[model samples]
Target: SFMVRPFSLGLRLFVAMTAGHILLKVLAGFVVNAGSAGLGVGLLVGIPSFGLMVGISALELLVAGIQAYVFALLTSLYLNDAVNLH
Candidate 1:
């Protein structure tokens, strides 16, 4: 039970963080590539991509804080379980 909990928790958090970063990179790439195209195309694509990137960046920051809190809470829960067992 102990091993399962930590392993699963870590894996889940890793996946979430990786996915978020990858999505951010992809969105940023779209904006950069669009800028290379032309003024009109760049205006159409770059604006939306930039806005989405900003929103996602904010979301990622919030998620990072929430993840830290969750990790700390779970650690405390595990410690409490261990102490109560003895």
Candidate 2:
């Protein structure tokens, strides 16, 4: 029950991590730009810049966790669907 499919889990985790990292960068850019101009978003200057990097890192970690959990859950669910019958 604790074992994960090596190749599948690896691939799933890789995909999640890559996608999450890219999304974080794109979203952070918006925050950075907004901080420079919009809504006197300049108010975000002091900490938002630092916050953006921290957010990206946090998101990557979240994605890693999600990938592991989702992959394992789905693998088990699939196995159950295929093998366990009422």
Candidate 3:
């Protein structure tokens, strides 16, 4: 039972990450191409494009970090639950 929660969390994290990575890759390709545009063009396209890239990056970091922490904590909790070492 102790192992159940942690294992479930791990699987959830893996699935979430896979989806995030795929979406990030597709958006990154767009950002890179849009990013290469010149100053005038950049101002028109690059600024917003880069801004979105930054936003997404921050969000991804925050989300992934939270998920990782949750996983670790769940693992620790499960370990403690199993050991029964008050």
Q: How many pairs of residues collide in each model? A: 0, 0, 0
For residues 1-86, write the lDDT of model 2, one tens digit per residue. 33445566667777877787777777677667766685656555535655766877887787778777888797787678657754
Candidate 2 lDDT: 0.69
Alpha-carbon lDDT, every model: 0.91, 0.69, 0.76
Rank candidates, lDDT, best first.
1, 3, 2
Model 3 per-residue lDDT tens digits across residues 1-86: 65477678878998988877777777677666765776676567756766777777788899889998888887887788778956
Runs off by more than 4 Å, candidate 1 = none
In candidate 1, where is summed lDDT lowest over 10 consecutive residues? 77-86
Candidate 2 — which residues are off by over 4 angstroms? 1-15, 24-47
Model 1 scores a TM of: 0.90
Top model number, lDDT: 1
Q: In order, what is each prediction's RMSD in angstroms? A: 1.4, 6.7, 3.7
**Model 3: ten consecutive residues of lowest lDDT:** 41-50
* Clashing residue pairs in candidate 2 (N, C-alpha, C atoms within 3 angstroms): none
Steric clash count of candidate 3: 0
